[model samples]
Target: MRLFAWAALAACICAAPTLAAPQISALGTPAAPTAAASDPQAAAAVRVAMRQETLPPGGSLPEHRQSGERYLYVVAGRLKVSNLVTGEEQVVEAGKMAAEQPGDWHVAVALGAQAATFYVIDRGPADGAATTAANNDGN
Candidate 1:
């Protein structure tokens, strides 16, 4: 009886804040994706959750590879993405979206005064190893 009464009181208190604080927007949320929705290559397995990354003014790229394709949407500022696949480099500004296909060699440098933020939705790696941290994770 005591436990039940205490539980009811706790629930009531928890529910009381349902109408108080307003919702604040987060810059980005990165998680593993599910299902091979739009990518033709990822039609066979579940995709990983989307990833959101914010690169500072001097942010550089690491060597990594992913099995699924990448769809990157720039959320803030501008960036210079170099495609080493064909010796190509391009500038991607804010409000623009770009796709980096599988096995493409590239590097991204922040082109703005502050930081450049972007969100990427793509398939996860076939193996559990994270390529982004390949060189820096241990450091």
Candidate 2:
């Protein structure tokens, strides 16, 4: 019985598809212009960091600015992000992403009655802070 089981498992494993090279799948198409197009210094090498954050219903992040570019992907629920400089506001839902250029002042708040979970990727100068509080006058 053990030998038969081992043979069956081996056969199943052998029948599974194998990849000859890495496969790439795009998440979604960007609706707005990319940050790289406007930032001339984007090509410079920078430090990168990733983190996951969850906000309870109605939770909010204080207005702040990133020393580097920030990319946020919503894992669950909806998040409302407001850009102080551009006066643009957007709601990013699950499976959607938002990007913030360096020095762009913004704030985010969880929407709906459920907790919102998301992943953040920050890319900035090697010695710069990830985020800092925005000026009171939105400078």
Q: Estimate each model's TM-score.
A: 0.55, 0.62
Model 2 pairs in collision: none
Best by TM-score: 2
* Cα-based lDDT at residue 42, candidate 1: 40
Model 2 spans with C-alpha error above 4 angstroms: 1-44, 129-139
Cand. 1 Cα-lDDT: 0.51
lDDT of 2 by residue, 1-139 (tens): 2343344334322322331211111212223433433454442333556667899999987787876556677888999888777777779898776776556677889999999898766655546565554656765
lDDT of each: 0.51, 0.62
15-97: candidate 1 lDDT, tens digit per residue: 23223211111111222333333453443333344556889987865744444445556778777776555555667777765
Candidate 1 has which clashing residue pairs, if any? 31-49, 32-48, 32-49, 33-47, 33-48, 33-49
* Candidate 2 global lDDT: 0.62
Tell me how far candidate 2 lies from the true structure as C-alpha RMSD in angstroms: 12.8
